[model samples]
Target: MWSRSDAPRIMIVRLSAIGDSILTLPVLNALRDHFPHARLSWLIADYCAPIVRGHESLDELVEVNRGWLKSPRTIKQVRRRLHDMRLDVTIDVQGLAKSALPAWLSGAKRRIGFSRADREGREFSTWLNNELVHPSALHVVDRNLGLLKPLGIDNPTVRFDVPEHPSEIKAASDFIESRTLRQGFVVLNINAAWLSKRWTMERFAQVAKYLADRYGLASVLPWGNEREREDAERVAAKVPSHAMVLPKFSLTQLGSLFRRARLFVGSDTGPLHLASAVGTRCIGLYGRAVDRSGVYGPQGIVICHNHTSSDDAMRRNKDNDAMRLISVDEVCQAC
Candidate 1:
């Protein structure tokens, strides 16, 4: 273990995937409490950096844009950039080569990361870390906090200070008002990164119809891409009540909408996790490909399909039988 200093410079590496990035919140909070006066920095990918960009607990955010380090010249540039930080300790929560390489290059004296058994690696990232953390079967958030144990932060508390935006909140409020929707609106996200996790549009329409008829709730379907927008449109067309397809909004605006929503229903995706982070009630529709362990919060009501032994098929997004097992009534009952 590294000896404690008055103001040790620390860097945390977690890159990509909105859900994984959000799960790293507790780690950041725990580090803040353990070393209140220490200089804390985070190395993150450009895409998902917006969520934690202007965070109050962070001293700096080192952004790595897409395809920056594919070439040897760029890799050296990245190495030189991190070397300039003079990081004393580097904690890598993302157990991947892409994440580990940068942390190793940061010139940190104590490079702490996951054990080899924790995750797969082609880049042999585990060899780079001076310290290894054996992971438990805990939720991803708890597991992230576990990385702090080596740094003398034993009792890591879970805290996610989601950066607030009043302007975005107002914009969300205005958009909802324009749709003549008060607070009791259910935001439906009908998309996922994998096809296996995405529920049928027919099922989403039925759920929307049921919620509208039973609870007098309007449904707002938010889409990220053209395919999702098309799916949202299809669901809206089929629903019997106030279901509308929402235009694209920034991540901050989406957070504001989730905060105002009475309920959030979606497949196992980033928005479902985002809604949970913002203290919104969410029913996460998950498939067998999704890891239900440690991902859901207390406010999240997860309804996952039974386990299947088709990992290969699920990876190819060829098997959606797991998602099919979740009935519309089951989702309504949870809501």
Candidate 2:
């Protein structure tokens, strides 16, 4: 294992989940700041690989197909790829068994990972690593950055620069043109991965309509999975005639679309975080979750609530205790 004195080829292993991957960019930047000329590569999931494809700080991006972990041929291919890369230091930022295998197989002299107490997963992943990054009372973004401390890198100002795809820029421009939207527009992303976290479709529709009537702002909705699309459609049905429901877009395309938006309002989801990363004003709806560690607002107003247990049972009660308590008036005031 290379000591702190030696600058070695490094690989950062942070796989899937778009929001989490976006948060890792600061860590990548810190590593570059510490080792300006060191060979640095990122092992990212195929789904989010496009977001960091042309990152200036990275030497190379190694794609890891999470689906392939279950297949022997895919594992063999990944193993061969790691063998060819000859990484000197492997850091497992995902802290999951799935992320650990790549680090173990990378044949790096120094394998670093979160300790068992800090991370939840198969314990063996930590056993395989040569070093452990102990847990501290830090944000996930800072924790990811802390992993670089072993390599002599310290806390650095977070900066995420996602490139704009030419095609996506054209598409967003065409979308605005098709709608005859001349002024600034607001992009409202209403869908989230968890059902517990999402507000009612009717509620989102009401918000969209309110924006159109009061703000005179054009609104667009972006959906990820099929269920999210259905939710968007439901919201679109109730929106003003001018508000549009946009089609699915790649991560890069989404970044481009977000950059052009005047405001972003969404559930605790990836695209919301992406918008926040780009310094867009955001109003995030968080339920049954902590906003401090995650779902934080980005240099803008944020309204967070924890849904009461009554809200969880589908009882249709308006308790207004936690997240459900966040009123439409509060959200509009932020916007």
The clash count for each model shown is: 1, 5
Q: Which candidate has the top score in TM-score? A: 1
75-105 per-residue lDDT for model 2 (tens digits): 9998898879889889898887888888998
lDDT, candidate 1, residue 106?
A: 88
Could you tell me every candidate's TM-score relative to the true structure? 0.93, 0.88
For residues 1-335, could you state the per-residue lDDT of candidate 1 as single tens digits?
A: 44445678899899877888887877887888778888899999899998898888899999888787777887888789788889999998888788888988888989988887644232577888878888874467777787888888876767888777788888898898898887579998988868777788898998898888889999999988888888889889997466998878988789889999999998767788788888899888877634523246678777876754344334555656778989999999998
Between which residue pairs do clashes occur in model 2? 305-322, 305-323, 306-322, 306-323, 307-323
Q: What TM-score would you give candidate 1 relative to the actual structure? A: 0.93
As a TM-score, model 2 comes out at: 0.88
lDDT value, candidate 2, whole model:
0.76
Name the best candidate (by lDDT).
1
